[model samples]
Target chain A: MISSSRFLPRVSGLALFLFLVVPAPSLVPARAADPAEIRIGYLHLAESKQQPISLLDEPTDDDGIAGARMAVEDNNGTGRFTNQHFSIEDMRLKPSDDAAAAAKSLIDKGILLIVVDLPPGMVLTAADAGRASGATLFDAGSSDDSLREEDCRANVIHTAPTRSMLADALAQYLAWKRWQRWLLVTGSHPQDALYADALKRAAKRFGSTIVEERIFKDTGGARRTDTGIVQTQRQMPVFTQNAPAYDVLVAADESNVFAGYLPYRTWDARPVAGSAGLVPTSWDPAHDSWGAVQMQNRFIKLAHRRMKAIDMQAWTAVRMIGEGATRTQSADPAKIVAYIKSPSFEIAAFKGQKLTLRDWNLQLRQPILLSDGRTVVSVSPQEGYLHQTSELDTLGYDRPETKCKLN
Target chain B: MQAQLIRRGRIRRWPPLWLSLALTVGATSSAFAYTAYVTNERDNTVSVVDLDKMQTVKTIQVGQRPRGIVISPDGKFLYICAGDDDIVQIVDTKSQQVVGDLPSGPDPELLALNKTGDLLYLSNENDALVTIIDVKERKALAQIPVGVEPEGMGVSPDGKIVVNTSETTNMAHFIDTDKRDVVANVLVDARPRYAEWKSDGSEVWVSAEVGGTVSVIDPVKHVVTKKITFSVPGLRSEAIQPVGIRFTKDGKLAFVALGPANRVAVVNAQTHEVEKYLLVGQRVWQLAFTPDQKYLISTNGVSNDISVIDVADLKVIKSIQVGSFPWGVAISPE
Candidate 1:
């Protein structure tokens, strides 16, 4: 019982099938050539933190991955015309996982273009792991100035605004508003300390004077309690009391320690800015100009949450890759990276400008949005802040100040 | 620096009927009149500007968010896209009132009409669909899915092709009219908001609002043949966002409205070069040419006014306050 008839192909049957199918392939040679497939990896560290103000303000489960997916969809839509297809591999690593090892695993899986949503150290580790193979890593999470300075890597392209850029954006706007004197308040955390340094540098650059510097020491208290608001209201005003009069109060609380308690709770009527109140960010929920509403609406419908600054950073990184692929008509990671680094490469992230990568540091140049948690108050590099190359460059560390070797 | 151009031509106060008739024939043809219509986005009204008088004659209240507008081929009716109302209101220009509504999709941002005026191609910006409706039937015949956030509609001169530009997808989706199906898609720069085809239909120009470039594409090959870049001495490159493009009667000159830069880039159409940037109102959004091609009106959104430019000299002749946000403009052919 070998079932000999099943294995046996009749001469007439085989000839008829070949006759119809073989000519079809010959008739359309273009169809025989498959579309160029671009594979991207999104690497994020699995972590969570207590959102200070509202429970609803926390990052969603998808978070950075959702942005990558949207960018892939956007790229695929544009890619279909050029006979290119885009696919993303999302890999989230635990706190204990090694970023370098995880990056290697993704490389083994045939992903050379990676969007990293990791801490600065992990982003560096991931970049180091991929550099030997000419892999490109887009840093969407960290805003450390050192990543674009002493610790810069040729393989890493930064999409997130650096601490210097954010600080300068606020400083320029504050200068425009004639708030030239600042009462600088910084948290005790290392990240906050870095932000404080950037703010100081910005103040010096913009001719703004820091009247006094106060460090808000973190005492490790519960963020949300029945009596927490009462305690915070009493503590903040007293802490800000008896300070010399300043035009504005600028905070450097990147660690989410106490900046949120400064607005309206200050001892004086002066406004709070810089990491809180009127903060400078890559993207905000209230931004709706220059065709941003469409982006916001699409993101809301897809992710069921408002897109955050980190999400926009991740979105921008993936879009940079997508823009490169669509423009160059290539799926090769090296070609994409080269095109991105070239002066001709520009990507628009609904920022009312064509964002380009800086040749020296590979940092994307974009306008920073100053938001008051409700609406975009202003955008900087404000009117008078001019630059030799681009006004956007005026907000960040320009070419002359670069310590980056890009090796 | 001037508030407006002061070109006071001698007024022939109350010319005789015979002399005026002769002058009208000389200016236009037998008995034609030119009327420029501007859609006011925030006020939900269409301001009817009289070219003969150089002022707004009447303001017809349309509905919520009236942006894209176009006059019929015979110049009897005007189609206005009231975006929030989700209906394309048909207004009888003579009556100065909405006569009916075209069955448009979810959100119609822009509309394109064929040569015969038999079909209307509408771009549903929110839904990513292009609805083609029969003008006579007043019903949609085809709802073709296009790229994301379709905002610009361009119908080829031959009436064989319709090109729709999507903002988010950064593409021009080409639909073959006979089949009413998408035949090809061409990738353009980011946030393409408007598209215009040459008179001969050989090529199409698409304006990218965010990419800050205008891509001229070959209709046959569906590829960008030339990319036009603009530069004004003090204007930031990012602010030179191209939108609302228009070409002259002979196709020798093209006028591109540069958003936020507040200038209209006068381009040499044949060479694909920017000849000059004429300063206009803030956030210039759309452009319209009078039938005689002697003047061009640009809708300035941020300034809430329209700058009328003398086409021959590329100078701003007059700035007329229209409404809160003037987004789209159209003119009736004399």
Candidate 2:
């Protein structure tokens, strides 16, 4: 209790230690600031907004989400040098949700790259919002060419195959199969009219003639019920009873309101093609040749689901980002954008040629595959329709016909 | 009597235990001694082989689409190119674990390590560029533009020359390692894939997958010097497409894996003559040789078995079952 000398020394030592430990924070030079992270946004249509068609299943979240995830993973996987990492923030819009507001929220989150799946109007609105945010938009849903034509935006890139490209692919195959005369059935919608326009253009390019044109109204009714098939059977045959004497019935039913019933029971007993019977797509699960099996396996393992054309498009878009990052060794958006637009660059998506983006419209030039519901029937560019630049340009808008000006 | 009995029992037990210990040590040292790493494409696993016993002892899971594998020159690490994952996975040879991943180009299919083990040349097939990676830093230093679908790659004997073969373009691009740029694009036959430089570095041999022949190109002149074609009775010319080509240590004998022909053609390098055709399993894709050059292993992709050929006799020795669709093969230098 009376160890005063020892207690005094201990107190003196504690004071010395405190004096040494305090202050001098300036010597450390605040830990170097972390690198800026790159964020990408994804927008898709909610399940309720998709037309209630029963011929095929509606696209799930995995279709768009998995692709964006793959793109991010691939980008970061190869973006190590540039210290760039891609993050996806997805916003799914319901039937009544404001698409522009949803896009604005994504932009607020520092997401400057967007992959969108929406209808034409919603896509245009999102693009307008994206432009204000200085974000780059990749449209993976809409096939309307007007988005790339009259309404073309400098900030947007169209990843979805155009309606004209799909129609041309189908028309080329039909022409090859000697189904020269087409009974064109147009639906009562703007989207259907666009598809019909593409079909007519393809028919002219491939030496096929439209024998007659008919209109199918969007008569609203219960699409899904236990008795839907019986009702469709009773209504279809009578509706198409007086069709023109054509080789095939090319139905322009993008909304799938009535074309699914046109096959096998057509008025002329001819085959049905387009939107319902034989459609053109970028990818199909049944395709197993040309190293597709490997890609399919990788997709299944990564996403835990089967791949669709939309997923493939997303994957390609993401892969393109990775390619740019890896090649430039820089994550600066300007550098990456430059590398992507460079003519020397090409990316292999397991298709025959390395794909490159068009300078004017930013659309990827690719060979389209014509598929029946079950399997791939043929691939287009059809041997003879040659282009001075690339054969793939023959399917879509060529250089001479382009209305896109980047400025 | 008690002392003698105790001494004898101790003596009897001592020798036996010592003998058992010695035998155990000997067998253990011989069994799991050398590590042989195999890249599995679909399973995403690298199977380690026990060289002494000649069997796969352990399987280690790795990144997606691990295709090319090469043990470091110092034999301390294994660099595996995971194509789908788009990185070169570095595995520590000592601990048999993935230590780090090196940044390569997008979709690296094949890789060739420099002699000093400091630089790695990776073939990024998707982007059509050869990404030069600094192995120690695990960073891509430069990307040299090449032809389309650049898959097969190899380094010259002196390590001064790098050759990349593009399948679709049918051209073998010769690159100067010092400059890190393409020096020449020698026109080859259709589907020029898989190139192998001679030990002396005088010429480079490339396999033409669709041409069914191997073009011997003079690297100095940058032209094809001669073409070697294979013909067999009852076999279509298209089926005899050549893929992997390798030469013996002395450079006197060359073996080419003729895909779909189910055979490996042994050629006299000097004479440019086919010595013999060793029958193998179906769809032979690649080959590897034991260190002593006494045994040759050919991977039959479709059959999923490795055909073992006795080098001396140039005949099929045995076939060992492996994983489904075994592609590339390499032997442990140790």
Highest lDDT, which number? 1
- Look at candidate 1 and give me any clashing residue pairs: none
Instruction: Give the CA lDDT, 0 to 100, for residue B160 in model 1.
Output: 91
Task: Predict model 2's lDDT versus the native.
Answer: 0.73
- Which parts of model 1 have CA positions greater than 4 angstroms off? A1-30, B1-33
Alpha-carbon RMSD of each model: 8.5, 18.0
Residue-by-residue lDDT tens digits, candidate 1, B92-130:
988999999887866688998998898999997766778
Give residue B299's error in model 2 in angstroms.
16
Q: What are the per-residue Cα lDDT tens digits for candidate 1 across A116-212?
A: 9888999989999987877889999899999999899999999999999999999999989899999999999999999999999999999999999
DockQ score for candidate 2:
0.03
Alpha-carbon deviation at A267 in model 2, angstroms: 2.7
